[model samples]
Target: MGVGDVSKRILLGRKLRSSQLGETLLPKRIALPVFASDALSSVAYAPDEVFIMLGLAGASTYIWSWKIGLAVAVVMLTVVASYRQNVHAYPSGGGDYEVATVNLGQTAGVTVASALLVDYVLTVAVSVSSGVQNAAAAVPWISHHEVVVAVVLVLALAATNLRGVRESGAFFAVPTYCFMAGVLGMALVGALRASDGHLPDVESANFQIIPAPGYDGGNLTGLALIFLLARAFSSGCAALTGVEAISNGVPAFRKPKSRNAATTLLLLGTIAVTMLMSIIVLAHHMQIKYVDDVSRLRDEQGNPMPSGYDQPTVMAQISKAVFDNFTPGFYFVLAATGIILILAANTAFNGFPVLGSILARDGFMPRALGSRGDRLAYSNGILVLAFFACILIVAFDAQTTRLIQLYIVGVFVSFNLSQLGMIRHWTRHLKAETDPAARRRMHRSRMINTFGLGMTLTVFIIILLTKFLAGAWISILAMCAFYALMRGIRRHYDKVNLELAADEEDRFMPTKVHAVVLVSKLHKPTLRALAYAKATRPNVLEAVYVSADDATTKALVQEWDDRNLGVPLKVLYSPYREIVRPIVEYAIQIRKASPRGVVAVYIPEYVVGRWWEQLLHNQTALRLKGKLLFTPGVMVTSVPYQLESSQIARDRARRDSERVKAGDLRRGTVRSGGRVPPGKQVHR
Candidate 1:
């Protein structure tokens, strides 16, 4: 293997065979972390959002925190159940994008695609940002360099994921499960201690939150109270950001993929709901004080909390309070929570690639995204997601609250559209089903999806109203941009496809063939180009040279005559010392003169071994080929004359091609045409 290839193998680990893709299929245990980390890790800060929003109404409104959690949980459960139907119905891994497209038409599909794609990018950004923020609680240095640390963490996650799904899942599983155990364990311990009357207060419990210009008094009533609660509920809905990932990733599950995926989805929802509600309940029980700004905390003496006050995250406060009796438990909770937050980006890494592949297959995305990498991972998609996530992290300074404003919009948009699509899906299925049970099941699913649609739509509207000006407008604009771009790509593909449709008119050959060789000097490459052009037996064959210097042009003409080369020479002069445009104009003139003829422009090119040798050669020929390609009735071909240095390259190419995988073995090998003479090179 070449150095680059070896380096790649070292970085990505061993290259898996296409057949081993089945080995990469995740079982429920591993798949849980691989797909559900984003939703699960929201326990780290999602409740803080609820607390922050309620803190705006002062501690009096904090009573609504658990209520907001329950509402978010309800929405999450409904969305999960709705997606269960999606997995069983459209288990090919198109997820919401596929469901919308197949049920509602191309525009709706692309709309959902745009939303989900945006959501995936935000998933990485928000998760990594939140993770880094959570880490800052333990690593105080991270607070000063949060953005840089967050970006580095994102790159690390990208590298881990590029190693392949199964491998990355292994790396993330322990941290994810540890996080689950830590948080749920904290809740259990906290609850048990409370029952035993030994539960301690949170570190921030004594620090009072200053209300943000509203609701300083008790018993606030009417529209003001309703909007504050709605805003809190909408903010809390951040918990639902990654719920749809399981539907998007159904294909990565083990055998009986849909059923396994559904079970995983249920598990994800139950765990997320359990953790989210548990954390909120613990925060309330322990009187955990959280705010967007630490400076908002005032002591009982009516003074701001001391300048040295180390305001930790909600998770930290709760961990400290619940695990105060055991130092190791506190440390474990903090470490696991931080690691899980960092690993939560794995959800986007997994979903974005799969969704990108599905989009590529449908011609709504770049074809390159559809290709699996050396490890059977969609590497391009992962890189793209990481790149955008880093941009958001850097742009927003890696503050979770800033990034969170742009968070739930995309997922909610996808949720609303997906449920709407599922509603149509079942309605369509019910029309075709004759079996009583199947029809009944379809109706039941339709009812569930319809209910989900209503809930998500209400939440989506509330999100737009509450968060549009906060930062969601960026996500909204990004979604529209993506939708338009996909449509533009599809249009281009459709136009090219229609234009390339086989027809009898296209079958007819040119009435006359004219071949022109682009020559710079009377070298072996030029001679080869001339000879190759003559071999085609065109109706008209000539040597075309661009005269940047009179001396060189005369010398070339003299050599052509002395060698008795049969083809006549045509020279085009360039007073400006240009080579490409004059030849391009000549070819265009030839084409215009004989519109019924095909002008074959053969250019002599170099085949060099070393990378820098390419810079030293092929400049004129490359320019001429680029110019000639756009001219109608003209075809540009390169006749490469391999230099001595190219032997290494040629041998390397041959040997590298020989390293095909086991599946590449032909069942019935057949030999074709005999090898050509080494003197000639084919223009493929």
Candidate 2:
């Protein structure tokens, strides 16, 4: 075993056959953690955001924290219901992108994709950073090292996900479920205590929230209150960030993929809504005062908190209050909160790569992204997502509030467009069907989609109005970037496809086939090239060599005659010690003489296995081929003679390919001349 082979085996584990891919299909239990962790984890901090937003209008505004939570829950459930329809209608895992493309056209589709792409990247950044922030509450060291810790967590999460979905799910499922139980358990305990009038005060209960400018005291009513509610509702909508992931990852489910995914989505929505509402209610009951700016929170008589005061998150405060009698309960909730925040980002890991594969397969992204690695994971997409997420974490210093501002913009963009597309989807299907039952179902689905569109559109506008200036524009800019990039890639692929498309004129042949073999020595590689050229039986065959040294040229001419070679040998002299330019000029001259003729420049090349050996040969021939490839009436063929080392490389490739046996990987099974070959080839 080679060192590289050993390392790869250690990194990816022993390879599984393609047929075992079914083992990777997620069961409902596993799929929940894999896809819904993000939405569910919102319980940890979403309530804090609600209170913080309302804090801008003083503690009096805290009266409506539960109301904002309800509104956010409504939007979230509506989105989940709409996506359930999407999963059933299009279970191929293209999700919103596919629906938008098929119904609203490609431009709209790419726009959604771009938004989702940016959103997924932010999902990782925000989730990991938030998780670290939660941890910082329990461990003071983490607060000072937030960005570094978050970046490290992102990398570790990415590595875990690279092990394929099922494995990562099994690994993450425990923490995710524990988090759900801990938060829900805390909420239950708090409710019981509140009913008995025994609920304890939170850490921030004594602090009075001072309203920001223009919203002090009774300044929040009418238009001001309406707008404040909208802003708070928008902030609370962060709970909806990962709702669409289930729709995007429907294919990851076990048998009856759509049904299983929909069930998981429902559970996710219910748990998330219950948790968000419960947390908000608990915070209000405990009188937890949370604020965007810690300094905005003061003590009795409007006095500022002493320099040493601390303000924990709303969830943190509620955890302390509800679990005050039992220290372990508080620690358990905090630990789970931190864990779920980190794992919530796994939803993106499961989603973005699959969506990226679909886009790549459709020619919007580099085809390399469409490939699966040894573990059957979209490794390229995973890595790309992690890299960008790390960049954002570093840029924002892993501050959740800052990253949160940029968080839901993309999700809402996708949400609005996706719902609009679903409505169109149902309308188009209704046109093709006539059964009373089916028509009724279609109309019902369309109604759901329409409601979803209206709700999402309203929230989308609110998000823009509320958070546009507060880091949301950064996400919008990112979406624009991805849109332009994908469009450009698609345009390139379309142009190439059109240019290479075969027409009847493609069958037209040149007046004659001219073959020129460029040789540097009387070696086996040269002889093999000569044989391959002769086998083709061109109308004209000749050998050409660019000679910079007169002595070597004389020796080669003498050797050619001694060998009695039938083909003509032409030696072009290069006074400047250049080889490629002279041969390119010769091929061009040949083409001009017989514009109707085709020139096949057969370059005798050496194929070496080791990287360094490749550098030792083919420098001149590579440059010559590059130049002649653009010449009219030319076909540059690399007639390669494989060296012994190539056997090792070929065997390595064969073993690597054995791990994947279906889809595009199976293309290797196609015999030569049947499928288009690799590398550049030009013909008139």
Candidate 3:
């Protein structure tokens, strides 16, 4: 046990039994929030974006919000149906990357991976930032500290996710459900109130929005209006950011993974569309006009009242009007909106890791990412997602509006690549199918993919054209950077594989083994090393020391003679008090003298527990081993002697592992190297 071991245990958490892996699987009730929150929570801000983009032309264009919402809903439904085919066809959890690489080509798969990675990062920044803004609406103290608040929330989410997916999923279920119920309930109540002539008007209804520099006072015709509308549609498509997570996480579901994932996707689309439409309708009835300026929203008069006014979110404004007389309803809507914003990023957390694991398995990422943790989950992938998401949060100061500019590009890239891949998959499969039924099934899949491809490609072009200068270029640059990075990693791995490959030229046998023991003074560690080297029965064995002082060197030589040591001691004189360099030079001299022989250097090392103890020892041995490694005929071996402090570290690790815990969900009754009992394979 040592400081390194302690740090590793702290980072990775205590090991869990293989049998307890089932405890990490999610039931649909919890999985919905875990995987669908990003899409479902878009209702809070999707309408805001729509209004914001339209506000560029003034509020007169707000009449078209429903049309845009409907278009987005149709695209979402098409994409979901298209992905149902994806999950069912390729349920190994590679998702878009797998679909593209297998069906399209390597280049397309890389394109999809880069897009998904960028999108996942934006998801965290946007969702957490939106959550912070919602919180600011309630607690003004948070307004000035939005970035700090978002960063803190990101860290908390990372810690929760590090506990395992099932745990975090269950924890987020309440907020997600509450958000759905609150929004749906408010919509219903507002509808009834409107029918009874008791509906309340939103605060924004009193204010006016000035059109942008070039517009027809928010009433326009021709290409200019169409372009503005397209930009709004692209922005509204932010609702689709997390839709692909279901396909990416198919393997995480229980039995019938593809079917479950497809069902979940349908549920996500229905809920998101319903919530989005309800909020838009309610906002229209409430006359909510969102403004980019918090101070400019006034009640027609020139007075800047209500402490300069902090404009609530689109959902907040709708909630304020719909629940004008019901304080609890307002609070419920506000609270749920805030909670869902935070949990929305959880979908990215779940998706990014799974996609990273797939990439790693495909040799595009570090192999450790493909390996499972104690929970049988891809923990490294989760950690990588947390790290990148935190970087984005800090970079953008957690402002959702600014972050939103970088959102849809990635999802669309993935969408277009995946759809194109699906089309290819059907074409390839249809070539082999002779039966009419099989051919018909493939044809149907192809048609679904063809429709999806057309829609996604159109949106992709819209996103690039409209958002290129409005910060979308940043995402494209990021995707390219990731693509180049992944390509470089693959190239490095290929080079290493070539270098390490075994061949006839490298199979030559060594003539003899010559063992050298590094000695400072005759101590227990040195004695142990000498004994161990002797047991190897090399062709020659000797003890070597470098002498910087004559008195100590003579005493050591006399002591060696007095003890009648079995091995001979060779001493070298050094003007400077250098130890590692002289030993390394001497080892090279021995190896150069006998080119065909192998020189084995046994260095005695002390194993200590405390971090500070490491600095006090092994300075020379470490340098010596590093230098000796380059010599062609030399091998370095460490002989470890554990000190008392090591026992404390070992005990600490054992306690942290919690081996005695009996009833924990992540604990199990299995012994070492044993299989789990029958009927205990799956966890709820």
Considering every candidate listed, which one attains the maximal lDDT? 2
Q: How do the predictions measure up, each by TM-score?
A: 0.94, 0.89, 0.91
lDDT of 2 by residue, 250-351 (tens): 888998999999999999999999998899888888888888787887776778877745567777778888988899999999999999999999999999
lDDT of each: 0.87, 0.88, 0.85
Which residue segments of model 1 deviate by more than 4 Å?
Answer: 214-219, 651-684
Provide the lDDT at 154 for model 1. Answer: 91
Question: Which residue pairs clash in candidate 2?
Answer: none
lDDT by residue (516-557, candidate 1, tens digit) is 987778889988988888888999999888888989888988
RMSD of 1: 4.6
Candidate 3 global lDDT:
0.85
Candidate with more favorable, higher lDDT: 1 or 3: 1
The candidates, ranked best first by lDDT, are 2, 1, 3
**How far does residue 236 in candidate 2 sit from its true spot (Å)?**
0.5
Off by over 4 Å in 2: 213-218, 299-310, 428-437, 522-524, 558-563, 607-610, 639-684
Better of 1 and 3 by TM-score: 1
Q: Candidate 1 versus the native: TM-score? A: 0.94
Query: Every model's Cα RMSD, please?
Result: 4.6, 6.5, 4.6
